[model samples]
Target: MLGPASVQDLGRVGQYRFGVGTSGAMDDIALRAGNILLGNDENAAGVEIAFAPFKLRFNADAAFALTGADGGAELNGRLLPPWWRACAHAGDILVLKAMSRGARSYLTVAGGIDVPLVLGSRSTQLRGEFGGFHGRALQPGDILPCDRSESPDDAGELGAEPADIALRQRTLASGARRIRVIIAGEYDRYDEAARQLFWHTDWRVTPQSNRYGYRLEGPPVQPIVPIEKRSHGIVPGVIQIPPNGQPIIQLRDAQTSGGYPKFATVVEADLWRIGQAGLGSRLRFEPISHQEALAAQAEVSVYLERLRASVRLQGEL
Candidate 1:
C-alpha cells in the first residue's frame, strides 16, 4: 500500500489503525529490518514476492536492500546482500530470483520511494483497491518516483551491509511447533482427522500463493467441527480452514473480516520465516505455550532494536 509519499507515517508511529484492510507487514519484522538498513522510512518501497523471483532495473544511482526471503538477489550478475543497504548504479539490473527459504522479499531503497497514500495507509490493498502504486503491483516500465526530500545524515547506515546469504542454506528450524497457530471461527466443525491432519501432517505450498494468502496442498482442511461463530476480524497469520478442509494462510493483504474458521495462527515473529518458504516448500506445525510465544516475540523486538541501534551507531562513523 502506497501513501501520500509525504513521509508522514514515518513520523506518526503510534496507535495501530485498522482500515477496511489491515495495516502492517505480512512480515513486519523483516520490512523494519530493511528500513533500518537503508536508513530510509520503514514503509519504503521494496519488492514483495510470493516465492517468485522479481527482476527489476534501476534507472539511476541509489541505495537499496533486500530483507526477506533469501530469494537470490543479484546486481548485474553479482550477488547483493540480503538485509543490508547498498548503492545501485544507474541501469543496474536487480534480480530477486527464487529461493527455497521463504516466500516474500522486501527491497527498500535509500531516501525511500514516493507513493500516494490511500485510506490513511500506504500498503497495497489489492481487494479494496486503495494503496500501493495505483493500488496494484508494479509492472514493467512503471516509474516509482523517489522522495528527493531525504532523511537527515546517518539515515542510511543501519548495519554492516552484506552482499548475500550463503547458497544451500537449510531449514529454519527443527521443531514441530515452530509454526504456532491460534484457532479462529468454525474450528470445531471439522472432524478430528482434519484438525489432526492439519496439525500433524506436512503440507506443500502451491504455486498459486500470493499476497492474500498461501494456498496449501494436502488433506483438504475442512471445518473438523461445524460452524457456530459469526464472521469477525482476521489478521495476517490466521489460518482459515474452509469447508473442503483446505486451509488458507492469511497474509498482509487479507480481507478485514472473514467468516471462515481459522484453526491456528502462525506466530508473528515466525511469520516472515514462513513467507520465505518458497513454493513446494514443506511446512509442519509446532504448537508452543503462549508464554513461550510471548518470550520469542520479546526477543525479536530486542533484536530489532539492537539492529537499529547498531546501524545508528555505525552511521556516526
Candidate 2:
C-alpha cells in the first residue's frame, strides 16, 4: 500500500549525470533494516512511505517488516512495533497512521516488492515517472505482486522477536534535529564571519523542502566578495548557498550539478537524520573533521551488522 504526498522507490543510483537522482528511501537505514528483518537484500525495492495514512491487505500469507519513523502501524486493529518483523495471514489488513516523529517510513515484504528494475534499479524516479509498482504511488485496489519463495510458512511460523533479539536504530527526538557536517568546496572563499554564522546559527527546514533539496531559513550567509563559478558535479550531501543566503541541502533527488557556492556537506552517516526530518524540522550543524566523519559511518555499519546478528540469534531461539 502506498500513501502520502511523496512515495517513491528510494531512487535509482549511479545514473545522475543522465539527470536522474538517487531517489531511494530518504532514510536508507530504515529501508535496509526492514529488508534485513524480512531476509531480503538490503537494496531490494521497498515502499518509501511519506506522511500519509494508508492501508494494505494481504492476498496471501506474508512476512513483512516496518522500519523508520514510527507510523503507528496497526495490523487488523492490533498495534505493531516499529523496526520489527511479523507475519500476516491472508485477508489480514495493515494500516499506517499519520507519523508523529519521523517524516517517512519503510515497509518491506518478505520477497521484496518484485517491481521490474529500471536502469538496474527498482527505484521510482517520480519526476521521470518510471519504475516501481507501475512507476507511481499505489492507489486503492492496486495489487502488489510478491516473490512467493519466502512465504511465512517457508520461514516457519514467523513473528517479531523479543526486544533483546531485535535491534533498533537511533530515534530522532522531537524538536530541533541535530545534524553533523563537514566543510566542503569553496569554504575559504567565504568571509570568516559568514563561515562562523553557518556553524553557529540554527536553521529551519522550510515547507518548500522535499526530496529534491531542503530549502533552509536562517541568517543570510554571503561570501567576502562575489565569486565566479561554473556548474559542476554535485552530490546529495552538498550544501549550496544560493544568492539569498539560506543554504539548500541537496538531497537524494537533487540535480547532478550546480553552480552555487558550496558551503558544507552533511556527512554520509548523518544524512538519515535529514531524511527522517519533516518540514518545519529544526536543524543545527556541528563541524567535524574528515577522520571523524569516516568513524561515524563505520559506526553505522557496525549497527547494521549487530542487527543482522540479532536476527540470526532469534532464529535459534
Candidate 3:
C-alpha cells in the first residue's frame, strides 16, 4: 500500500458552521462516474487512492470500477484501462501501479464501501479522525467492508470515456491547464504589477501541495501595502497570497476559516482540475465573471447527466 488511501463520498455538507471542514475525494468526478457505472448512488463511498503500487484482494465476488488518473490497474494480471468496470471473483487481486497521468484514482464497488456516516457523510476526515473507515488511511492488513446489495454478476465488463475527453472544455494555447477563477474581495488590494503577474504567469504546483491546499510557485505577487484582517469563513477553492507572494489554493480539507489575503477563488466547477494537477504541474488562471462560473457549473451538470443517461441505456440493453 502507498499514498493516503481512504474512503470518501461526495463530501460532508451543512457542517461548516460547526468548524468541520468538508473532507472528500479530491477528484469527485471520478468517484461519481465509478458509482454511476456500478448503478450506485452518485455519492456512494469509494476508496480514493492518491498514490500507486496499491494491492487489494477480494474476499468475495463483487463488481468494481477504476476511475480518475490512469493507475494502470490490473485484476489477476489482466490489464484494466482507466475508467473501466468489471467483476472480480473471490480471491481475485487488484493492483494499481504508479499513475501515468493524474494525481489520484478511485476504486468503487457495486454498493460502495460500508463505513459509518459521521455528520451525514462517509468521507475520511484525516485532521479530525472521526469519520470514514477508522478516520484514517488504509494500512497493509486492513480489511474494508463493502455493501453488496447488488450482485457482482449483474455488471459485466464496462467502461466510459474519461471526463476530460467526454466533457471537452476549453484549454490554454500554451498547453498549461487553464483554471477559471473569480476575483475575490482582495483582488484590488494588490498593485497592478502583482495582479498582472498573477494572471499572466503559469503557476507551478509545488511538492508541498496536498488535499488541504495547493501551494503554487511563480513570480512574487505582493500587495501595495501590508494588510491584516480577521479570520473569516472560507471554502474550498479560495486562493490566498501570503507574504511569500506565492499563492495557495485551499481545497476540500481546508480549514473552516482563514485570515490570509484572498486573491481569487477557483470556481467550483474548475476545482476538480486542481485536484488532479500533479506535482510540478503548471496552471494558468483565467478570470471569469460570476455568470460564466455558473455556466461552467451547468456544463458539468450536463456532462454528468449525459453519463447517467448512457449508463441507464446500457443497463436496459
Among these predicted structures, which one has the highest lDDT? 3
Q: Which residue pairs does candidate 2 place in steric collision?
A: 10-23, 10-24, 10-25, 11-23, 11-24
Please provide, for model 2 over 7-126, each residue's C-alpha lDDT reduced to its tens digit, 9 standing for 90 to 100: 345567778668777778778877877877877888877777776687889999888888887789999999987666888889999999878667877888888888788897887766
lDDT (tens digit, per residue) of candidate 1 on 32-142: 777777776666655555444567788777777677667677889987655656667789898877653455566677766677766656666666565667766666667
As for model 2, its CA RMSD to the true structure in angstroms is 3.5
TM-score of 1: 0.80
What TM-score fits each model? 0.80, 0.90, 0.97
Query: Candidate 1: where is the Cα deviation over 4 Å?
Result: 1-19, 51-53, 151-177, 185-194, 220-225
Order the numbered candidates by TM-score, best leading.
Answer: 3, 2, 1
Clashing pairs in 3: none
Question: Which number leads on TM-score?
Answer: 3
The lDDT of model 2 is 0.77
Winner on TM-score between 2 and 3 is 3
- TM-score of candidate 3 relative to the true fold: 0.97
